[model samples]
Target: MAEPGRQEVVRRVRELLARYRDPAQVDGLGDDEPLAVLGIDSVTLITVAAELHQRWDVTIADDAVLDPEASVASLAAAAVAPGGAGDRPGGRLDVVGMGVVAPTGHGVPALWDGLLAERAHRLPMPYDAARGHRAGAVAGASAAEVVAPDRLLDLVCLAAGEALGGLDPGRRAGVTLVVGTTDTGGNALGHALAGAGDDQSALAGWVAERAAEKLGLGAAVTVGSASASGAVALGYARDLLLAGDAEEALVVGADTVSKSAFHGLAALRTLGVDGCQPFHEARRGIALSEAAAACLLRRPVPGDDAVLGRLAGYGASSFTTHMAAPESAGIELALRRALAAAALAPGDVSFVNAHGPGTKLGDVAEMRALADVFGDRVRTLPINSVKGLLWHCQGAAGVIESLACLLSLRHGTLTPTTAAEPVDPQWREFDIVTKPRELADARSAVSVSCGLGGVNTAVVWERA
Candidate 1:
């Protein structure tokens, strides 16, 4: 089913808003007026959204529901609500190719080996002392070795090159590019401050532009929702394809170690000095890593060997709960929505690639969310976190871990989490795999990401 026209959407939104406001207030409400200023609460907005979803059968993101500036017209424009959660804006997008450059290794083969071997490649922290003694720096690569002024951009090009290599040149026409990063060229700005380069090009916009130019792709849209940036970018690209706005999408996620980023994490006390120990009783916090990962997505082609897997479903949600701490309700909503988007039941999910930043509160919140959504099925669900092995790659972590899901679909094995023993008693019902486990007949996986500003995202992938 197609989404309603802009006019219809606007009319429906305005009609709903009128029910909550006084007739005078409704009459005075301008299209640009802030809903909050007019005494509209979040619950009222959510109620309106629920009604709209029931009416239009389209998926409306929680971010829009909680947005402070949400007005009737803007909400209508953003919702485009076509089919409900059970309906995908577009059909499944095939992941034709993937590439990764991480602290564990570069390229898919090396990455798979390192992950299956459960290796934690840590290096002495080179940035801020407050970030701890060890960090996950990409092996054998420095800022000077890359052609781009920013190492982050260089990583993007490198990973994109690999993913694009498998794509036929004839199929590259009008390919949209989406880059995700929290510190988009922030390190470049640091160098510009030292008078080493043009300061203007060091801005976030230039990072996306330069990366798209370097990769011979279209003007890039960058997503920066902290750790959820990659997943959000993937979801955004999927929506574009579904909406017929683009024929193809090259989604890239990259982040490099920076003093500012380190200090921020340090301020939050989320740096793991010893190492990331997800779901463990003695878990400290995240071991920051620099990584770049890319995936090429397009409409599925019959008998295409290059097709790695299908992006079966994706969902995103944001809460006004807490800045750094995660809320289980938001996480569960995203997960349930993604499953609905995929048209899959909780029992169908083979395993989960969790965010698991190894923080005290963050890990517990995720577990509770998983338990909430999966219910008794949590006891058998093989949930694992790669952060203990590859460390948290920040903005790039989502796609990097997503690639792990594809690899699992391809290899029929579930990678283990490192040092996950002495499990947190709170989640004893959950199976946190610490050793490599064969997938057997499993054919699907879920990757969940939660970030600062109460951002949450989930993507479900099925073997293609």
Candidate 2:
């Protein structure tokens, strides 16, 4: 293959930019001009990287486009240079770092505090009693505080901003933005069309456009499922990076409860009358809640502070397991698959961030699956749930829980699974952490989540 020089890289980037720019802007574009000045946001920049990767196998770092000194020539030199960091085996595949936006806290720091303190944010449902569901809210923050009015897209944007903090904007912009939501802007739009619902496609479009704008990204895409949205987002991010499509990707998972979601859960009789009580002997059902979380991912790079944990493996599976009830088989399959992909055994996991929503069946099924896969290891590994603090944020649960898992690895502490009196009789062998415990040498953690539609996703993270 012919090596590309700085001039060649510049020529390719300019061509990609031309697709979305005004003819005048395209003509005015110069090698030294900032891409943002030419209206090249993060989404468009990723498009450019995709095009370049397809044509020249060039791997651009997230900061390349944002750097003032990163001229077209310099970018080209980096892209075409043989044995460049970007061209190395691990160059295109790094977790570099992650960020979080959850109920217990806003960023990773706050999350760590909440976990260490063993705080519980679960509370009675804020909506009308007639709605028939309680929830575990993120303490003080309200939907308005976390999101813009009737703008679910804004919540995603806010989460993305928090996740990208302390990172180079130019480098961040170079990656793709993939979001996961059970209900994208449904909470806001549902209220607007209480009687007659609006077009779902239009709502989706608005969310994507607004999120892209907020993040200064070039493209915005979303994946939806009941609870597995977060896992799906990570899985997709990994795929994109591994395909050499982009050097960096931002994966965000967010969702808010509304009348629609509340009623739907109530209709299924899965709504808890009080707060959620995962693994409790007297567990009733789940309490719907709201949450948003974002993670910054890149091809692994050494010495990146943002990299709290390296994403080692991901597994997903779907089954026709009772549509209304939990499915142990599918959950176990997903967990096993993820472990296999990571080339790890069940014993390798030191902690499990269970998708405990405080529901009787849901919690039981998840525990059963854990026992099935981990066997004797289940008795030794510490396990906890963030639901007692954040409630069940639908699509956002996985990512929010992931933030908790990452914090656990970084802080060497395990958050107690609140409201869980003891390991359910059915789950006798598991070492469910009812109180916070000191975690040492905690190098690896797993996050597991199961969605309503039989979607299950598991992700393994290793200390970086």
Candidate 3:
């Protein structure tokens, strides 16, 4: 078969681009203009390229699609090039690196060591709610100190730089940054503005840009979905790679405990006076913390060197449940969607990384969802949450927890949930992995995240 001419390519590309937006949004769009000028955002451009690859039986490098000077005509030409035909030649997407800043410590090793030891790093909170609340934090950074709005950028740079470490500058430019963050350093920025006046203000909210510069990357996208933000970012990264939008994608979930969170959680009475004891019969509420988690993902070339593990599947679901509570239906739907995406079943899952935050309602809902979706297997299948140990990292919860799953896949050891109170009698069927257990086959497990506003997400982790 012969390649389609430029005219045919242009027509199809235009038709596709138009589908993403109303005609008015691209009123002045030209075949020779950069797609961005026509209001086509990076995410939309990625979708367009993926569709082009799938529909036209062609493959185009991500940069070509993102090139500003290159017009629709040029992109069309590249798509129909003789070498462009066919699905991308690769195995599957894999998690290559991870970086984390949790209460346990910074970096992946610290995270693993702390988790294995089942250490709890609580912030020492002043009894005076106005002063602060919690036990102690890692590296001498109390939750109060770490949660300062200004510390968010510090966390992002620390984690992202680690994730991209040892990568030559050239490789960094080829990677796209997808940052999921709930803490945006707003209070810090506002204070700075008040001090310096408008003319002397710093760009406090340019987090993604600052992160890109710190990590030597070209661009970044910021995703926010409350506690599920990090997982949502991971979901986007998976699609970007599967669509050939980038050679690699870096996802960061970072959030600092802010004054607002403190006040709100305190008011809601969700702050556990002691450390978080998830799913305990005497469970209180969530213990909020400041943290950042990062993961680097790449599509695998056949016979590639190696990877930590493969992010086989991810799915998210939303339902109009109360903002402060979770509904089992949405949680189950998200889990089933992820399993189906991986072509696996509940029986195939080795274990579940639950979103158990210890809240009476949250834990109960998640447990019921697991029992309903996995059936009697819930009685024997291992399920646990890092929240018992890590505190509630909020937006970073998803990313850090998912990283735990990847670690288990690599080490063949299923980490245990910290020993909390006994299981709530109403939900005794679920097998909470309360003690460190070695997995006979840690090949596949699902990591879950329950967020405010009914946002729920799940990602499938598999052996590389």
Could you give the candidate ranking by TM-score, starting with the highest? 1, 3, 2
Model 1 spans > 4 angstroms off: 1-40, 43-89, 129-131, 142-149, 199-202
Clashes of 3: 7
All-Cα superposition RMSD per candidate: 5.7, 15.7, 10.6
Worst 10 residues of 3 by lDDT: 196-205
Residues 224-326, candidate 1: write the lDDT tens digits: 8899999999999999988888888999888877667877888888777867789999888887788899998988778777778999999877753468888
The top-ranked prediction according to lDDT is 1
For residues 1-464, write the lDDT of model 2, one tens digit per residue.
25536666677677776788886686686766666676566545544654565356455654664455555555565564434543332222345545555556556677778766766454445565455545545556654443233445655766778777766768656768888877745555654566544534325446655677666776677887778887898888888887778777888887766556777787888877756677888878777766678887777665655555678888776643367676776677678657766767788898999988888678878887888788777888788887765667887888878878877787788888877885578765678888888887888889998888678889988776
Residue runs of model 2 more than 4 Å from their true location after superposition: 1-93, 120-126, 130-132, 137-139, 142-151, 194-205, 302-306
Instruction: Give the lDDT of residue 302 in candidate 3.
Output: 71
lDDT of 2 at 279: 81
For all candidates, what are the clash counts?
A: 4, 19, 7
Clashing pairs in 1: 57-83, 57-84, 58-83, 58-84
